[model samples]
Target: MLIKNYRTQFTEELTSIFDEKEIESFFYIILEAFHELKRVDLVLNPNLELDTIQLLQWETVLSQLKEQKPIQYILGETEFFGLPFYVNENTLIPRPETEELVEWIIEDLKIKKFKDLKILDIGTGSGCIAITLAKNLPNASVFAIDVSEKALVTAKKNAELNEVKVTFIEKNILETEDLNQQFDIIVSNPPYVRNLEKQEIHKNVLEYEPHLALFVEDNDALLFYRKITELATKNLSKNGQLYFEINQYLGKEMVELLEKYNFENIELKKDIYGNDRMIRCVLKS
Candidate 1:
């Protein structure tokens, strides 16, 4: 069967479960992953055919899509910060918002003229942020810690894929008793989503994505933020900077938490959607 024909059928089948935009995105992602074809390829060569084996593979992926599995997991890899990263059920899929967090870090480093900077990424799922920074800032020493050994394995694979050296450790952020060496920068996109908001999330995420990397008790939504901030105040180098991708609903509270810890230059920035999504603060020496 022709690739174009299968895409149309796949889109129709997915439309029942996902919205028009999501279905379209899914179609494009699958095409790229399975056939090495882009949407433009389909447009230019509408009659391009898929062999029987390819068709069966496409059908299997389509079935998973119907079941609301994430395309990143389906492909077992994704692009983040212009680098390819391996992902799975063990790791949280890197998001564009987190990419923005990486950009902020790079920009700040450029302005500081700081080299050989020691940096730490808390809960570094897939090691996207740490690896990206290590790749972009060659002189920087990057370290990442996550509770899940499986996630750390995926992160290690990503670092190797990007050909960047990063130190990956298996440690629970909430229970971390010490980080012996101080760091010039600390960054995290820790679980800030309140459990009560689960219903608002799409089935594809709530059902398939790892909840251990996604949720917090509604009553303790700032749990990770509190723990990381406390550690940063003690373990960050003189004038070290801390960054976070935060829940929009609790931006003010997040800022206040940092302020109480005496972090200076606390700034809250919005994402493309104009929701408060990022925070950066400097820890005084």
Candidate 2:
């Protein structure tokens, strides 16, 4: 079938679930993943046709999309910080907001003259943050911890794919009483979405994404943040920095929690959306 015709059929099938813009985006993503035909290729060569086997594969992908499966999971991989990562139901798919958090850390490191820096990434699903740090800052020692062994396996595979070394260990952050070594930088994109907000999430996410990595109780929304901050006070190197990708709704609360621990230079920054999406704090030297 011609690319144009297939797109029309795909769009019509998905129109009920997703709008025109979303369907278009999904179409190009799947086309590139399955056929290596990019959006530009489709525009320039509108007559490009899928062979019999290719048509079968395209139809299979379409079926999954119709069922509201995430395009990333269907492709089984995604790009983050210019590196490819394998993703599955065991992990939360890396989001662009998290990419901003990673960029913030990299930029901060560039300004600091510290050498041989040690970094820790808590709840390192898919190892996106830890692997990106190791890949970007070649001299840094990176360690990541996750509660799920299955998630850690996926994270380790991503590290291998990116060709960067990161130490991965399994530990529940809530139960983590000690971190033996001090880190020059500690960062986390912990589960900050409250259970009450689940109604606001799209069905695709609530159904396909791992809830263990995305939610906390509405009454105690800052559970992970409090735990990580407490540990940072004890384990963070003097003058070390702490970073978090936080819920925009609780920016003030997050900053207050850090301040209660005597974290200095606490700054809450907005993401591209102008919502409070990230925070940075420094430990007293």
Candidate 3:
């Protein structure tokens, strides 16, 4: 079958589930992932043909797309911060907002001229934050923790895929008392979404992403944040910094929570969409 005609059929079938632009993106993404073909290749050769086996593969992806499955999960990989990561139902697909959080950390560390620093990423699904830090900050040692063994498995693969070393730990943060070692920086983009906010989530996310990595009880929306902050107080080195990618609706509560821990130099920054998305604070020496 001609790739262009197949793309048109794929688009028509998925137009109800996703917008035209998204459908187009999925088409090209699958093309590259499955056949190593790019948009230009299709454009330059309008009659590009897919063999029977390749057509079957594309059709399988099309069916999954009809179910509103995320393209990343179907592809089993994604790119974050210019590096590749393997993802699955066990891990949340890395988001651009989280990339902003990472960029903020990298920029701050670079500006401070810090080196040989110790860093930890709590709830490191896919190890995106921890691995990226290790890859970019060659002088730093990175550690990551996740309660889900399956998620940690995927994260470990991602670390290897990115060719960066990160210590992966399997433990629930709320049940832990100490990190056993101090870190120069502690960061987390933990489960902050409230159960009540599930309706606000898209079907692709709510159905396809891991819930353990996405939600907290509404009565204790700060569950992970509070626990991690307490651990940071006891585990951060002098003048250490802490960062979080937070729920936009609870930015004020996050600030209050940090202050209660006596953290100084608090700062909350927004993502590209201008939502209050990330917070940074210091543990005073």
Q: Model 3, 197-250: lDDT tens per residue?
A: 999999999999999999999999999999999999999998899999999999
What tens-digit string does per-residue lDDT give for candidate 1 at 148-189? 999998999988889999999989888886788899999999
Off by over 4 Å in 3: none
> What is the C-alpha lDDT profile of model 2 across 1-285, one tens digit per residue?
887888788888888999899988888878888878888888899999989998888888889988889988988999898899999999999989889999999999999977679999999999999999999999999999999999999999999998889999899989988899999999999998998899999988999999999999999999999999999999998789999999989999998999999999999999888999999999876
Query: Which candidate order results from sorting by lDDT in descending order?
Result: 3, 2, 1
TM-score, candidate number 3: 0.98
RMSD after CA superposition, every candidate: 1.2, 1.1, 0.9
lDDT (CA) per prediction: 0.90, 0.92, 0.93
Q: What's each prediction's clash count?
A: 0, 0, 0
Q: Which model is ahead, 1 or 2, in terms of TM-score?
A: 2
Which regions of candidate 1 are displaced past 4 Å? none
